[model samples]
Target: MATKGRRALRLLGAPHITVACLLWFGVLTVWGTLYQADPLHGLHGAVQRFFHSWFFLAGGVVPLPGVQGTSALFLANLFASMLTRFERPSRAIGLWIVHVGLVVLFLGGLLSRQYGRETTLVLADGEKASMSVSETGWEIAVLTPGAEGRREVRAYDVRNLRAGGSLAVPGVPGSVGVVRVIYAAVVSPAAGLTPSPEQVTDAPAASDPRMDRPAVVLRAGDERLVLLGEGPAAVLHLEGGGEAHLLLRRARLPLPVSVKLIDFEKKFHPNSGIARSFSSRVEVDSGGRAREVTISMNRPYRHGAFTFFQSSYMDNPRGPEVSIFAVSENHARLLPYAATLIMFAGMAVHYLPRRRRT
Candidate 1:
């Protein structure tokens, strides 16, 4: 290697650089915890500022390195150390394996952050579905009823739309535009106004974003329709004697496999209204085959890259029970475990001796 190149590698592998990165990492952890304690900046804000970004504007002005940059620097240090310091072969085999394991852990975390997804799968007894819903994103769907009661759905993402912004929905005549969006509101019938009256007024937005009930006003053809996130579908009669149902709802994600709620059971406390435990018997159908599995409080079911846990349950006074599963997809699910095992083996090789020194 060139003289400059060798010097740069030595600098990268310096112990002081490693120490500084570790100290910065600990500072970030402490600061993130303290920042989340404030009501204005919750856990999401802290994560976005500290973990997601490479650098953040400290106090909305000065730039400061975050966990992302720190991790990158730490990784560079490890690589440089392997290339510059651990150049021998006879007695450094275990050290090489240990370094490789540490590298895997850092790279695995990066891959997981880029590809991991978290969503909810909701199913009622005897109902099977292959789609999960996003927790915070909202969409507008237009459903046209077809033969055999099946509806053709055309959904548009409206989470980024501002007040009075428009959406050009396919197969719908004229313009479809949004007038207003309320994050949380009280919706009611507007009484004697025009042909019908759909009234809505604003309310306080919930701190937990999932609890927010959003409403959107859309101009479909010539009629103005009010659609609520968790409300009933509004119908718009088309010019050709057909009708389209308008709905504002959480965004749905298509899944690789279908899951059905075979049975849902929950046990209450000994004598109180609080629930003690719940479980779901689900049938996962994939690749033309089906199998049954139980997902309970601590036991989660894994299929392919997705894992499902019994997150919550709901009991209707007049209807059936609903089972909600928290599903997460992590492509690097086993990387951490593999890295840990490799590290342990390397440590044993480096330290353990069968017949010598205590």
Candidate 2:
């Protein structure tokens, strides 16, 4: 067992491990670069799908180790080298400093990946919002009437559902079982069907053809109902008494403060219809205190751990103008700067000592 352990240590500390990881890293970079030309992933999609994953498909066909896997192995190789290869005092201190810098950079990246969040906040003129919704994730919201005629809301992430998934909530009659999910569908009323005031129009006219709305069929005991994303929520009458309303919506995150859009201004070049810039003036309400801030093309508003950048605006000359802010919350935002400084210090120390000797 002791011999096996020594062998394992030597294998981990081998120089070839580092070489192999670097080779794979280069391959992944090139693969992702080539894959981004296709529309499936887009600019950010390649990094999200391939670079950060453990294993991902190339061209949706070939399998390859992702950047995360290669990085982890490279870190392990460096750690093993520190333990077994750098034990002697004669080793160059400059090289050790460089390694330490690299370790710090890697650790910072890991922390950012684990804790960082990116979302968007959209507000029409004079509108206020306290929560921002996610761009991708979907949720099933159950709205029921509570005591004193107040409404209560409970949300469940749709990612947790499957063909036989069951949901049991308090005050709900029987178990709610998912029959099936239509990932993309256009709900149309049957022929000779009468349209109700709550019924939504079938499939949007200008929506992307590739895009699909989610629809679900759920069963509770003997009753079954179909819920469509384009229409009003399916209202279920409970056997015990009250009513339950189920609607599909984007997952939301609460903000530390609420923001109200005061005004949106757009500038145009002289004698041209082209836009020069756009800005939004917003009032932030935290607790009972209120403050006003302006966000523009290059300017961002920073509060606590959140930063809001003016990203876009809707074109509405006659109606209320809407502003979109790209919200980013990253605890390790300064990690890259610190890592760069450490690397510069390492290089300077290495070169200055050698120059003095010369």
Candidate 3:
């Protein structure tokens, strides 16, 4: 048993694993870059398949491990090396800190990938919002119409579900069983001579997920309903008189504070239509204490654990000026900076003494 444990530790801390991971990183870099040049699969698609996913099919046939898988392997290697190789010797002290720093950085990346969220909040001039929504995720919102044109909207989570999974919609009788899903669907009116349901065919996924219109067939209370995400909500007549409206829309997260866009300003270059700089002054209201802050290209505003950066500006031809803010909630973002400093100190300890002696 001791011999087997030693062998396993040796394998985990082997230099070949490091070399293979580094080489795979290079390969993925080149492959993702080449793939990004394709119009259909842009940077987002490339990153999703190569960097974000645990596995991706190469050339649509060969299954290969992605960056997430390689990162996990490298993390294991670092931990094993720290346990089995690095010791309390004075000369090894710097190596110990370096390995520990690397582990911290890697774990931070993993935590950010697994638990962190990236959401977007769009505000037109003079508009305020307390909700930031997911860019590529969708959820089902069930609406009930009330008296005097008032309606109650309640959203349910569908992001964790697959085609075979079920979604528990509140206020509804039965759980919605997902029968089929088309991520990028082309919805067309029924074209047959006889009466039939609409035709939904899968199309190539849009580079921006917001542009993709999904179609889903759901089994809800013995009624099989086909709903398209782009159009009007599918209605389910209630036994108690009124109807329940169901629509799949972008998932949203309510913020603790409300943000209102005061004004958006843009500066253009001399004699050119190109934009030189742009910024948005926004009011953040928390507990009725409102404060105005500027968010620009280089500067991000932080409130509590949330950080908002000015991500996009749209000068809508038909309406008001729109400013989009990228909101990130990653508590582990500071770990990488701390790990970098630790690594720097380790490198100084490892090299400075040798330099002085020489």
- Which one is best on TM-score? 3
User: By the lDDT metric, which is better: model 1 or model 2?
Assistant: 1
> After superposition on all CA atoms, how large is the RMSD of candidate 3?
3.3
Collision count of model 3: 0
Each candidate: RMSD to true structure?
5.2, 5.0, 3.3
**What would the per-residue lDDT of candidate 2 be over residues 1-358, giving only the tens digit for each residue?**
9888767877897899989988888887888797777776565667766676877776679887788777778887877776677676345566667777777787777777767777789999999998887665567788888889998888877768787987665567667888766555454465122222233233432222224466667777776766665446877776678888888776676788899999999999999988799999999999989999999999998878788899988887899999999888787877778878888887887789889999
Model 2 RMSD in Å is 5.0
Q: Give the per-residue lDDT of model 3 (tens digit) for 25-117.
A: 899999999988998888888888898989999779999989899999999998877777775647687888888899899899988898888
Residue-level error in angstroms, candidate 1, position 44: 2.9
- Write one digit per residue (lDDT tens) for candidate 1, span 1-358: 6999999999999989989999999999999999989987788778878987799998899998988888889999989988888789457767888988998898888887777878899898999999998887788887886779888887877668777788765456766888887778665555322222247778776545667788787776677877777677887766667777777888887888899999999999998989899999989899789999999999999887888989998878788799999988888988899999988887777777533566
TM-score of each: 0.73, 0.79, 0.87
Clashing pairs in 1: 190-197
Ranking by TM-score: 3, 2, 1
In model 3, where do residues sit more than 4 Å from their true spots? 89-91, 145-152, 162-177, 189-198, 204-210, 239-241, 348-358
